[model samples]
Structure formats: C-alpha cells, structure tokens
Target: MDDTCAGEKSHLFCGFFLNFSLFGTGVVYTLTSATSMRAIQRANCYHRDGHDAPCSVGGDAYYMFLFGLAQAVLLQIPGFHEMAGLSVFAAVMSFFYSFVGVGLGVAKVIANGVIMGSIGGIPMVSTTQKVWRVSQAVGDILFAYPFSLVLLEIELINTHEMRFDQMKDTLKSTPPENKTMKTATRASLVITAFFYLCCGCLGYAAFGDGTPGNLLTGFGFYEPYWLIDLANLCIVLHLLGGYQVYTQPVFGFADRHFAGDAASVEVPVPMLGKRRVSVFRLCFRTAYVAATTALAVWFPYFNQVIGLLGAFTFWPLAIYFPVEMYLTRNKVMPWSKQWVAIHGFSLVCLLISAFASIGSAVGVFGSETS
Candidate 1:
C-alpha cells in the first residue's frame, strides 16, 4: 500500500480495512463456532426427542465465551510459525465437513427424486426485495476471495528470514515466488470452487427456495443426526484454528507497532527456567477476543454480518488497490487499451460493491430493527 499510494492514505485506509477485515473475521468465526456448538446440542436433542420436538437450543453466549476462552489461550502461541500444525488440522477438518455437507445434500436430492430450486431462486415480496437479496448474495460470494492480506504473512514464514535466503539461493533452479504463488493460488481456487459448487448446488437442489442459510445447522437434514453432529464438530474444530490464522497478522502488527521490546514479564515453570511473556500481547489479545465474542453474542445474524463485511471491503482491498498498484508499477498509460480495460473492470467491480454495500447495510440494519 505504501509503495502504491501517496501520503497517509495507505496508513489511513489500507490499515483500517486490513485490521477491520481481520477483526471482522474473528467476529464471524466466533459467531460460527457458537452456532456450530448450538447446532450440535440441537442435533442431539432432535435425534433423541424426535425431529418434531421443540429442540430449541437458545442462548449461544455460553458457547461464544467458551470459544473466546479457547482463542485467548491459542493466541498466546507467539506467531504464525507456531500455527503450521494447527493450520493443517483446520484444513483437514474443513475438507471433512465440506464433503459431509456435499454428501448429505446429494442424498437428500436423490430422495426428493427431482431437482428443486428455480432459476430465479426464492421469491420475494417485491422486485426491490429480490434485488436486495441478490445484492447481498453477491456480497457473500465476494467475501470468499479477500485472502490477499493473508499472503502478506508469507514474510513471517521464517523468523530469521532463513526461508527467503534459501529461496534466493534456489532462484536459479526454482520458479520465482510470485509465479509459484500464482500457480498454488490457481490450483487452490479450482479445488475450492469444486467444493463450493457441490455444496451450494446440491443444497439448493435438495431444498430449493426453502434451503436454509446453513445446510447442516439449519436442520435441512434431520434423519442423519449423528452426521450433523460430526459436521458441526468439524466446524468448531476448524474455526478454532482458522481464527488464529486470520488474527495472527493483527497480533503481530500490534506487537511491532505498540509493544515493541517493552512490556515483558517473566514467569517460572516447573521443569523449565523462567520464560518471558509479553504483557501487552496478553492483555490486547484477551481484550480483542472478548470484544469479538461480545459482538457475536449481541448481533448473531451470520449472513447479514458476512455480507456487510464483504461489501465493505470488497472493492477497495480486492479490486482497486491491486489494480492501481499494477498500473502504477507498469506505468500503464491513461488512455492505453490495457489501462482502459483494467480501469473499466475496476469500475464495474466498484459499482457492484456499492450495490452490495447498500443491500448488506439494509440487511444488517433491517435484521437489527426487526
């Protein structure tokens, strides 16, 4: 951002958006974890008491606080380097649950004997309402693509910069980092799109316009209660580590900018000698977790919150900055074909983002009011 933008705009806007996205992710993850926990309880209740029973597992506050406590402990893991194992575990759990969702959806669709859902999707009271829903749906989709900031954590892959030095040594034999990253990104996108399409299309086909926002947790499938429990468990486990992945960057930044070399406290262990802990990291991360949990408890509207965050950050962080930086780097002429095409694309995305923002704002505020 500093390389591309002038003056303090980078710090003001980029810093704000980056931190906001990370913080917002923590909030979403907290909500999701609580929701999943509640789903597990409700699933069990419905299974034992029958699906027709009122298995209303209300009050996610306890679950939210539990998740927050887990985060508070995990965030003390120092940095992203320590989270490699956790990341792998989370990835595995994510794939496990995604497959479960897909499989369940397929089974339900098969039982239904006909593909459900119309091309227009669920009908609304008015055209305006339908447009709002479509816009919010666009925002939800856009939310999945803003991991650009996560790539910045590549800098933290090694503490002593050994990784970069090793890469530099292998530069003659190996492809450049950018090319390798792009290749990995493309492959990941393909894999992710496959699962996303399977889960989404299958869920819609199974339940049509009446499909719940969440397939597993929304009681879309009741017969396989044990499977739902397992899926929700996977979700909880995944979010536990996924939360750390998104928040580590923010924690690192705070350590650098605010804490620095100060605020150390030495605590002795039973077997090991005294180890120094950052007093600042402890307090800040704890407070941050608590805040996210509180917000999740207060406004538990999952889809609405996601849409608002996505719509808020999509254009600037995902489209505009990258486009502007690319143009600036290559010195693309203002009236040139390449420049015009890129700018046109950005413009279209900006309009879409604006539309999404309005719709998401409506959803969030409307949900709150109602």
Candidate 2:
C-alpha cells in the first residue's frame, strides 16, 4: 500500500482497538462490581427486602445506548469547532465537576473507614488502607483516558472469543441450535466496523493530509457539525447513567449492611455537607459535559487528538487487565513465549501512539500560528 493508505489503515486499526479496549474495561468493571454487590446483599440477609440488584449487562447497555445517541446528535451542530473562546471556562467547569465527583466518592469511602475504625477502636492507619487509597487515585487518573482504550480492547477480545466458542459448539453438535442472535450480532458488528472505518478514514483524510481547509472538509462528514448537538444530548444521558452506576454500589452497601443507628450511616443529608457536595458535583458534571461537547464541536480537528489519546492511554487497560485477571483467578494461562510477544507488541504500540499524539498536537498548534 502507499504511505497515505498505510497511515490511514494504521489510524483505523488504532481507533478500533482503542474503542474495543475501553468498552471491554467498562463491561468487566461493571460486571465484577455488580456480582460483588449482589454477593454482599445476599450475605447480609438483605435479599429479602425486595430491592432490585444491579447488573453489569444492564449498566453496559445503558451507557452504550447513551454514547451512541450522543454521537448521533453531536455530529450535526454548526460552528462547534470555532467555539474555543469558551475553552478555558469549559475546562475549568469540567475539572471542578470531575473533582467533586471524585471527592464525594472518596469521602463516602473515608466515612465508611472511619465508622469501621470507631467500631473496632483502632487508632492507627493500616497499610492496606493506604495502599487502597493510592491505588484508587491511580485508577481514577488511568480511567480518564487509558481505561477507555483498555475497555475497547477487552470488548474486541471477548467478542472474538465468543465467536470462536460459538463455532466450536456448532461443530460439536449433530445439528446446530438457532443462530439468529449470533448472526445478527455479527452482522451488527460488521456494519458498525464499516462506519467506524469510514469515519476514521474521513477524519485522517481531512486532517492528516496537512492542508488548509482540510478540517472544514472533514467536518462535513468525518466530524460533521451536528455531532456537537448530538454529543451534548448523549453526554447528558451519559452523566445520568454514570451517576446511577456510580451511586448504586454505595447505596446498595449502605442499605444492606448499615443498621439504622450505626453512627456510620452516610445518608444524604439535606442542606448540609452531602447536599453541598451533591450540588457541586451536579454543576461540575453538567459543565464538563457541556464543555466537552463544545470543544468537540468548536475544534472538530481535535477529534483525531481525542481518538489518539483515547487509544493510547486505554489500550493497556482494555487488553491486559482481563487477561491478567483471568490468569490470576484461574491460573490457567501459562507464561509462555506468546505472552512475552504480546507484551512487547503492546509496549511498542503504546510508545508509537504517545509520540504520534504529541506530534499531532504540535503540528495542529503550529499550523494555527502560521
């Protein structure tokens, strides 16, 4: 293939890989958390209360639907890319909002810790607690971009494995069972992949060619003006889904385990500490969603940057975590030669992606200056 064609292919591959990785991570985390929460509810004899438990499948589907819907809207808005005059405000708002959400989540955990300590009369910091807090912060930062890529990788791997398993089962049977769902799913995958490929190609063609007005041309279809409006709506739904998913575990834990007068009841206090925090979180997340939508709209050219960052950071989280978890849990996958090769490949891809992102950022800025 020619250099341009090869570059386009590489970009497409990276985009698909990243999306699959990030989505996969989301699925795994949601499922595992749901399963653990369910077990906790059962063990505490709280299952008899008739409360509906959370499920990973439901959460995943909800977020996916929201994301798809948002993308559809965001691609249709005009002047979305030139609104960078509001970038600083948007960024600040998003940062504060994200910070509040993080703080609230952390505060709840700390409150739980304090209550446990009070019950036990323990006065010292435990090594596990320190490690956990540090790990949680690291996880938060990683999830910001890297985790998305990782989730996408996991999704792709899981899908491939499922297909393989289905094929194997069919071979083993005298007559295969109805393959309607599997066929439809595969068909959907093919169609989605085709559209994604087209978007990636159009994005690269519009920007990667390093010409004037390329961005405008690309935005016509690749980054389309309407995407901003769509993104805004999608983001709002995403935030709602995210809030639900994030709060469900904490609510579940509190409801099932905490007794009415346990001094550890971190119930939502009206017009007090909890309310203040909640308001801040709501404002922040709303601003964040708005800003992100605006940025994507105003600088349609940045879609490539977003894609690159999403792919680079999240690829490891998506592809490696599940494999690591599976190996740790089952002790089935031996550390063979193939494992070494995969790790090496992952590392190289990461480095390339990182450098390319930096280079692209510099180039975009340079072009604007000249």
Candidate 3:
C-alpha cells in the first residue's frame, strides 16, 4: 500500500495479520513438507524384504535434514531460477503417484470390501480419546480447503516481494492481467479441491480406519518392490519441487529486506555479469533451511503440526486478510452489506479455528488413544 494506508487502523491491522500469519505459516510449511519427505523415504525402506524402517523420529529424517541443507546450498546456482520450468516433471510425478495410489487403492477396496471408517471415507470417532482425536481430526479436515487455497494465491508466482504492486513495475501488465490472475486462481482452486478429495477418498479406502500419517507405509504388497520404490522416489521429487516453491519466497523476502535487491547479489559467473553471491546469500538462507530441518527432525508429527499451524493462522491469514484487504483496497465501507457479510464469514472462520486450536492443544497434552 506504499504507506498510503499506514496511519489507518484497518490497514495496520491487515498488515499485522498478514505478517504474523505468514511467518507462522512458513515454519509450519517447511516442517510439514520436510516431515512428508522423511515419511516417504522411510516408507521406501519398507519395500526391502524384512527391512522396514520406522517412519517417525528416525534416521531417515536426518537424510531429509541433509536434503534440505543441500537444497539451500544448490539454490545459490543461477540455474535455480529455471527450477520453475521443472514443474512439468513435478506434475507428471504427481499424476503418476496419484494414479498408482488410486489404482492400488481400488484393488485393495475390491479385495477388502471397501473397508472405510465412516462418512464417505471420513473415519468414525472411537470412544477412547474421542474428545482429543475427534477434535484434532475435525481441525485437520476443516483446514483442508477453501481459505487454504489463499496460501497458493497470496504467495505463488513471484508475488513481487510478497506484496501486490498494482501491476506496475513488478507485474508490468495491462488491466487484463488482473482478470487473467483471477481466472487462473479460481480454476486452480477448483482443480485442487477435486484432486485432494479424490486422493483422500482413495487413501482412506485403501487402508481403512487408523491409516498412518504417510499412506505409502500401509501397503502390504511388497512383492512389487520396484514399483513401491518408484512411487517413493516420485514423492521425493515432488517434495523437492515444493521445497523450492516455498523456500525461495522466504529467501527472496529476507534477501530484499536485508539487501534492497536480492538479484544484485554478485555471482562469479562470466555468463552473468555483475552477479556474485553475497555473504548474506551464503549465511541467511542456509541458516533458515537448517533450522527448519532440525525442527522437522525434532517434532516429526506431520498431521499434528499441520493441524496446530492451521488452527493458529487460518483465521487471520485466510479469512481476515482477504476480507480486510478487500475493504481497505477497494474502499468499501466497513458497515456496508458486503463488508458485514465478509466480516461475518471471518467470524465463523475464527470460531472454527478457535475450536481447532483447542483440539490441537488437547491432542498435545492429553493421552491420545487412537
């Protein structure tokens, strides 16, 4: 907003919400994804005959820890910018994993009588630890869609130093850019929801009740070891892409705040003149990645971390930011019908998040039977 709205209460409040939620979200994002990488890698070990590695708080996590550290170092290469072009490979791998998971899942259902917990693939709440597990489950499921799409919207595709720049120097496009962005965002959201629902349905059906955090671990067919190994390899590739997608933004943000223009970091490459890696580049991003990897190894609870993270940020980031930013940017009166409706929706999101937060706390402190 170029400090135009700095003195205004609404604008300041929006900035606070955005920054606070984004910081929390970044940590959770890194840890959760790194944990996923660890889980899949460990699951791959299960493909070995009589050699099953446990998935949580184990040695494989250290391997992912090294992977994250290596990513930070390799990201310094100028070619790292071309990583976005590798999305085709990521997409292919994602589709391959999805098809494999679903195909095997269907065969499993046919053999196992479509064994599911309850509610169309949603699990039933058991009596033991019902309060804690059910509440945590509710929070996790609620965090799955709608507003969560805002994370992709707000952060993806070179967000111009993580702020909207009015299609000026940063975006540098005609008015149609706005329309294109909106259309793309909506389409992406719909596609994502559909795919997520399908994956959940298939995964839940494959293993029935009490599925593990990583679905690949639950498979019994170790005879096709190569296929299992390939599937887990795809998971690694997919997570590596995601690591770039998320960590680069963090690097860009910190680099800009510290060094004005991050691209100006001089690299010792003849093909690129006046580009050299600054000391800040050497130290900051490396430290950030190392810290997150360490935390991922420390608290390997994938779903719990995500649930608690969602509980804390979902209200302010997703619901509050969009509504508040809309009113502030578009100059909608706060008391108008649209404003009231938006705030009311935000209120509902806040209530849901509050319950989720409580549930996550209960899960952490109480004895979880399920």
What is each predicted model's overall lDDT from 0 to 1? 0.84, 0.37, 0.60
Tens digits of lDDT, candidate 2, 103-122: 33344345445321222222
Clashing pairs in 1: none
Query: For residue 297, what is the lDDT in candidate 1?
Result: 84
Which lDDT tens digits does candidate 3 get at residues 23-100?
444445555455445545554566543455553446546565666765675567533345544554666677786677
Best by lDDT: 1
Clashes of 2: 42
Task: List residue ranges in candidate 1 displaced over 4 A.
Answer: 1-8, 149-175, 266-276
Q: Any idea what lDDT model 3 has?
A: 0.60
TM-score of each: 0.91, 0.32, 0.74
After TM-score superposition, the amount by which residue 83's alpha carbon in candidate 3 deviates from its true location, in angstroms, is 4.7
Ranking by TM-score: 1, 3, 2
Task: Give the local distance difference test score of model 2.
Answer: 0.37
For candidate 1, what is the TM-score?
A: 0.91
Query: For model 3, which pairs clash?
Result: 266-275, 266-276, 266-277, 267-275, 267-276
Off by more than 4 A, model 2:
1-189, 198-278, 290-300, 330-335, 364-370
Sorted by lDDT, highest first, which candidate order results?
1, 3, 2
